[model samples]
Target: IIATVGNGMVIYIFTCTKNLRTPSNLLVVNLAFSDFCLMFFMCPPMVWNCLHETWMFGPFACELYAMIGSLFGVTSIWTMVFIALDRYNVIVKGLSAKPMTTKLALFQIFCIYLHGLFWTLAPMLGWSRYVPEANMTACGTDYFTQTWHSRTYIMVYAFFAYFVPLLVIFYAYYFIVKAVASHEKSMRDQAKKMNVSSLRSGDQNSTSAEFKLAKVALMTISLWFMAWTPYLVINFSGIFQLLTID
Candidate 1:
């Protein structure tokens, strides 16, 4: 309920307010939409299963549920990667950066969904299989299978879906911080030379924009790691035989 309502509000605010519909903000809306899809499409049935203390859905429904979750989940991950990259370009380049346009943002969003579709469909095509988890209340990739084919799929998927995106996010934010720090140092030095209390004269708008985007990106990245790290650990443990499934 929290996820559904919160993401729904974000989408609503961005859609109804014309002034909030900038290209950069469109990316935020995209993130919210992806999350909304995840919660809206998958949560109710999962809740039903939880209430029953078991997955009442049959095998086909289980596979569909897992696919929907994985598809949106992957898109959300890559969307954040793009958001971080966008912030790095805008904040680091400042006024010299090319402004984000709606068309370009839409194109990027299309690519994100396409990337997600590819991975999620691979499981259905025999790269791996979707099956109920040990708890029998949720479905996901078949992590318990010990064959080389199954293990290979998990490893490759983890590399692309988790590790690569994580590295890109970190790289973007690391440089974002360095750029912000450098700018602050320059401002302080210039202020001292001019005998002024501050050097922020006409660049307040740009500075404010950078800070806003940085703050959002920071929050997004932090929440992302918090939510997905445990899932990643579980997948890895399963692949490595660290987990014994009944």
Candidate 2:
């Protein structure tokens, strides 16, 4: 449904008009394109797997399908990290970093495909590699189920994918929050000295906005914990098990 709506909108916007294809929107379109790929590539197989719980399509079909799915999934995930970096750069550096040109965005889009290729195609043909066990030939996927690689990849993924992004967001919001707080406190101190009449309106508004940002950061941290922490914990346990085994 999300992909359907989102991609459909992109298609409609891009094809329907020429003017809306500005550089930044074009980047958005590229993102939507990947997201469309991500959703369609990942979901149908998941639905199929859920209903069947086994691959009826045979090994070749499974490999091809899972390869595409996992590739796009990783693409989507990494692209999101890219998007966060883009956003952070924009906020911190402002128009100096500027809008990515259409050509640049297309290059970025190409990079995403290559990035996906490393994870998905490389594993299949055995370059980057995912070694399949005998009898139960499966795609090198569901990192959670692969006890050994899962732990390593999971930790790396969490650190690079989650922690770094959170840190950026935290620092961004922290500065903004602190600036506002400092301004508000200054205003309050001035008000204490002077007439309290003029201080009530915009002062309160600025303070409110600062607190709202703080709240949002808190919520974001909470959601991150809920979303990825369990997988991290599971990986941590697996790592402990390996050390014990050693």
Q: Each model's TM-score?
A: 0.94, 0.59
After superposition, the stretches of candidate 2 with alpha carbons farther than 4 Å from their true spots are 14-19, 127-246
Per-residue lDDT of 1-246 in model 1, one digit per residue for the tens?
999999999999999999998898888999999999999988898788889888898999999999999999999999999899889888887779788898999999999999999989998998989999878788999888898877898899889999999999999899898898888898899999999998676658767677777977788788888998898788879889999965
lDDT of 2 by residue, 153-188 (tens): 546655654576557656655655555567668878
Count of clashes in candidate 2: 0
- Steric collisions counted per model: 0, 0
Give each model's whole-structure lDDT.
0.89, 0.57
Clashes in candidate 1: how many? 0
